[model samples]
Target chain A: MKYVLSFNLNGLPVDTLVKATDTLLDVLREKLNVVSPKRGCDNGDCGACTVLVNGEPVRACLTIGLTVAGKNVQTVEGLQQDGKLHPLQRAFHEHYAAQCGFCTPGMLIAAKALLDKNPKPTREQIVEGISGNLCRCGTYVEVVEAIQAVAAGKYKE
Target chain B: MAEYVGQPVLRYDGIGHVTARTRYVDDIQLPGMLYIKVLTSPVHKGIIRHLDTSAAERMPGVAGVITAKDVPGKNAYGLIPDQPVFTPEHIRYKGERIAAVAAVDEDTAMEALEKIKLDIEEQEPVFDPFKAMEPGAPLVRPEGNVWEFNSGKTRKIRFGDVEKGFAEADVIVEGTYTTATNDHAPMEPQVSVAYIDETDRLAIYTVSQDLYFHLGMLTAIFNLPMNKIRYIGGTVGGGFGSKNDIHCDHVAGLMALKIRKPVKYRHTRREETAYTTKRGPWTFYFKDGVKKDGRIIARYVKTVHDTGGYAGMGPYVVDKNSILVAGPYAIPNVWVDGICVFTNKPPCSSMRGFGIINGTAADQLQTARVAEAIGKDPWEVHFINAWREGDLGATQFKVEAAGLIEAMKRAAELAGIELPAHLKAMSSRGR
Candidate 1:
């Protein structure tokens, strides 16, 4: 049965009928045409389909769409504000953290969640923050460096 | 030229990737696009007795059910055309495609696959390459386990007299080594979108390491003109040689043509791990003859590669192994034999080093063993026997600018290891 699922997406209120079985990833990518939350692995293991639900990072693939009915959903597409790239996004680009970029969206979201909580994160903390995301290109060194740069105020929010 | 050559340049697709705007195969959506799911064999080896797709065809959301009979042109396609597009008579390995369904949605396609009835008589599977080569072993293919080159023999390289070199050597070191099969394990699983364009040409958008190679494979399988198929591939998410295969391209193309709409086949993570080819495992035996002074006299390697299930680039892999078995060394006598043997695992294909990496590791390990036996430092022994200019390689190619000695010295310096004055004085040219 489909129910009216109302949620705040990128600070905008959205109302749509979503099936109970539909995942947040399906609702975002398939229904809303929001492609930032990539379906790297439908299972939550890869963390490629990560989005912020009520400011907490969650795997969109695993999160049921109905559960986010009254919550705020933020994706990688929401990162840029008024034609300005997010600090993490700029840091990622400058540090060359994304190679293939399949893992970047989720990596960026997870990094953003970490920074929002702790403004200054150490290298180890950054590693723990994005541990859910996996990059096959072996870009972890650069990813950690990019997150460090963001925390170090290399790119201001 | 030098300014750009040695400098780190930004990737052209970096911004697209960082901003989550990159269009990977799965990200592409066309109007009325259909999703595909395949029905594969569950056993390593089996004879298909019965297959009924009528029930799957009648399923509510399944648009089309495709079997081996639906292949318009050729049933087989590969580097060596041994693998069938869909297994008809016998299942070679578990996860071999038997049929596929085109449906309104991925869930419907998967559900349709479950409805397709299939019966198979299980057969004894040969898992080990060594056992596969043994007499009385079940054949993975009709032609037998070991692959025969155009010359009707396994790859072999012979440069000098093996017996004479060993007879003259002061020390001989021999060892057996084995390396496990490796998966490329790219972040993005195999995915492709195929549709007929306004020009009536089959357009395929997929992950590819080489567009031409993928195009060629598709053309061969579909028996279509080269100009008739348009291949669109620019961005790939970390192939590591795995994405070189036309994984879902041809299959998606076939479904798209039959359905007259865009069809996307995205392999699940489990399907990618279980079904995709891996780097072939190798069992290597190395024998090295060294003089008392640490100058290597001879090296011989007999490597057997486990070319799983089908001959998917196995011949080329074995040939590469034959060429680089001697490693970067100045050996007076060299003999190398690389054999590609079949097993019931997924067909192995290219990876980071192609085939030379495993052979080189075996050769180096044997070199270290030879150094240990003669009470010589491994680094010093390697320096003494390093291939310089004018050295004949395994394939009889004259080494014009070998820098093994210089590289070793530089590596030692970088590693903060203070080598002896004599070892440090080694050069690429004859010292």
Candidate 2:
């Protein structure tokens, strides 16, 4: 049986029918054609499927489709404003982070969630923020530097 | 002169990667696409007593089932023709592919795999390379446990008389070391999508290290013409030598041709870790003869490689291991033997270090032991025995542009190490 899920996605109302067994990641990627969220490990060990729901970061692979019926959902695709790159995205590019890019979307979403709560997070706090996401290319130093760059107002207007 | 040759430029795909726009094999979607799952062997060593696939074909949403018989032309494919696409008679190791089913979706496909009946009679399995080579051991391969090379044994490297060199030596060190098998553990698991394109040619999209190599293997396996298959793959999500092997491309292509629908196979993390190829384990026995003042005169090494199940690049790796058994040092008398033995486990293949890392580890340990015995700094010992520009290596190859002395000196300086006057003036030019 399929259920109709209606929610706000990236500041826009989205209505889609999804299977009961389908995950939020499946619905977003297959039905909605929003492919920013990845399926690094469907078991949720690697947080490549991380997405923002109601301004909080959660693993979309672990989140059920029906649970977010009336919630706010955000993905890496929603990070841009007026076709301009987000501060975190810009900082990631500048710092040479996101090698192989399998974990970039989830890393960006987790970073956005961290900055949303504490805009001026310390280096240690920034490290703690995106600790769930894993980049296998050993780009942890560059990723942390990118988040720290944003926190230090380097990417600000 | 090129301006950007030596520059630390940013990654070419950095922008696409950061923007979440790079495409992977899993991100592909097509019309009338079917998912596939391989039914692997559960027992390590076994004989196929009974096999049934009718139950899987009758399952809901089951499209097709392919076994060894379903292979169009050949059942074997690899660096050597020893590996089978589906083992029909005997199962060499656990997780060997026996059958594969395609269905409307992954859940249905996996359910179909559960419906297939497979009966295997377990046999004694061998896990050790040395134990496998013993007389009366259960042979993993049809010929024998020890893989033979053109020269008789797998590999044999010999030089000046080792007994004479050891007799003249004042100090000798003997040691044995073993290295464990390592998994590549790339972020992206092995996945592939196969379909016949508009031109009626088989097309495969996968994460492959070399497109031409996969093309050649698929051509030989499928008995298809060179123009019949199209391999499209360049970008990889951290292969690190794991994706060099043809993983799901051949099986997925066969299913696609049988059903005439795009077939997708995605290996889960568990399957990737438990079943796929990995770095081969090695056992090294080293005997080094050195002078009283910390100069290694002769070295003899015996290395045994555990080529699991099938000869998946193990022969080639053993050959390279034999060539590099002496490491970077300049030893006058050297004799090395590398043997590739078959064992009942996952097939071992290429990794970051083909086979040199294990030998280097053993060499470094022996160097330090020799230093300790002669009461000298390990760095000083390495500098003294390091290869010079014109020195003849154990393999009779002359070293050119030798930089070990300079590199060691620079590293010492970086680490704030102060070397004695006699050890500090070492050069790569003269012995």
lDDT of 2 by residue, B1-431 (tens): 59889876777787777777788888888888899999999999999989999999999899999998888878887777688888988899899999999999888999999999999999999998899999999989889999998767659898898888899898888989899999888878899999999999999998998688778889887889989898889778778778878779989989988888898988989999888888999999999888987888889999999989988888888988899878888888999988999999999888887888888988888788889988989998899999999998888999999999999988999999988888788899997
Question: In order, what lDDT does every prediction score?
Answer: 0.88, 0.88
True contacts kept of each: 0.71, 0.62
What are the per-residue Cα lDDT tens digits for candidate 1 across A24-94? Answer: 99999888888888887799898889899999999999999999987999998889999889988888998
lDDT of 1: 0.88
Error of 1 at A6 (Å): 1.7
RMSD (Cα, Å) for all candidates, in order, is: 1.6, 1.7
Worst 10 residues of 1 chain B by lDDT: B149-158
Instruction: Kindly list the per-residue Cα lDDT of model 1 for residues B1-431, writing each as its tens digit.
Output: 88899888887888888888898887888988889999999999989999999999999988898888878887887777778888888888999999989999998999999988999999999999989999999999888999998645578888889889999999888999998999888878999999999999899998988788767878877789899998898878778989866678878988877777888999988899899889999989988888999987888788999989998888898998889877788788988888899999999988887888988888778888888999989997888877888977878899997888888888888999999998877788885
Report the error of model 1 at residue A63, Å: 1.5
| Deviation from native of the Cα of residue B292 in model 1, angstroms | 1.9
Question: Using lDDT as the measure, which candidate wins?
Answer: 2
